[model samples]
Target: MKKIVYAGLFTFFVSVISFTARAESTVGYFGFEPDIITNYIGPSSKKMGYVRVTIDLMLTDTSDIAVVEHHTPLLRDALVEILSKEPEEKIKSLTGREEIRAKCAE
Candidate 1:
């Protein structure tokens, strides 16, 4: 009976340690570089402005950071393309920003 109890305790301790390590490993944030979209014309069609954006990736795993970084170029290109196509009115509003955020998050 004593030997069984000891084995159980050992198993529990090992499981707790593994759970703690995994929990710790999955906590943090990673920010991508700023992206700028230039030469975009405003409502007036004559006035031009640029849109600058930075994205922060909420990561639950450290390995995800490396994965995100690896695809940074493609991600940047897609985001820039999306931002460049947006009209001045859409880009200037709070809702528009939220919409953009959602799109990027997706």
Candidate 2:
């Protein structure tokens, strides 16, 4: 029957599309938008400025995104680790700048 044949073809097409759907974090774009800014004043006016963290935050899947339920914590952890490795001056000036790109690229 033509109807049966069409139904089978439709199912096969859907399967192929689902199988070909790619999931990659880099392609998903999970990071900060516009920018992430924070201010810090320390040492009795000896130092005062803002830190900007730029990033993209997106999910490749169609499911609802819940950072707590997903591996998204890895993103924050990586940034923290990188910040820990930065020189004191670097962290003071651009606290999360160097890490913004690195985290999203992961």
Candidate 3:
């Protein structure tokens, strides 16, 4: 009887510890309230194009979500500024799009 109780207690403790660790390591995602929309330079000097993007930030820990929420406005503005400066060709091409994504990640 004592051995069974000890085994059960040990299992419960291990389960609790594992659950806590998993919770702490969980990833969190935060999305912008309104999609970012901005105008970019078109193929020709006389033309102009606009792009709309929805961005979601992935955080390493769920607790960091609040920090991201607090700075959402600034993050949206920065993304808009980055997109607005891009040329139409870069905005449309795959490689260019990847580059833009990398820039945004930075």
Candidate 4:
């Protein structure tokens, strides 16, 4: 009985450790090329200021890095289109910027 109990405990511990190691997330940061995105702010009569944005993507698993990099151009174009639609005032405010970012995330 004693031997059986110890063996069961050891097996449980080993399995638990193995499961935890496998379950751990492998995180990676991927930066799209041409890191800086520069575009003129929305409809302004006077000299329109340009907004420069730097975007970096975080992947829960390293495998996603390739997938995201492959779609970089599409991501950039979408972001540019979204920003271009926003008014100059929206780009200037924190809330507005957050809203824009949320939209891009969606």
- Give the residue spans of candidate 1 off by over 4 A: 1-25, 34-37
Candidate 3, residues 1-106, lDDT tens digits: the string is 9999999999999999999988767798998878888999887888988998888888988899998888888888889999999999899999999999999999
Model 2 residue 104 CA deviation in Å: 11
Q: TM-score of every model?
A: 0.68, 0.33, 0.75, 0.68
Expressed as tens digits, the lDDT of each residue in 65-98 for candidate 1 is 8888888889888888788878888788999989
lDDT of 4 by residue, 18-69 (tens): 9999879699898766755556655656656778788787888899888888
Looking at candidate 3, the ten consecutive residues that score lowest on lDDT are 22-31
Q: Where is the poorest 10-residue window by lDDT in model 1?
A: 32-41
Total clashes, candidate 4? 0
Q: Backbone clashes in each candidate structure, one number apiece?
A: 0, 9, 0, 0
Which candidate order results from sorting by TM-score in descending order? Answer: 3, 4, 1, 2
**Best model number under lDDT:** 3
Model 3 collision count = 0
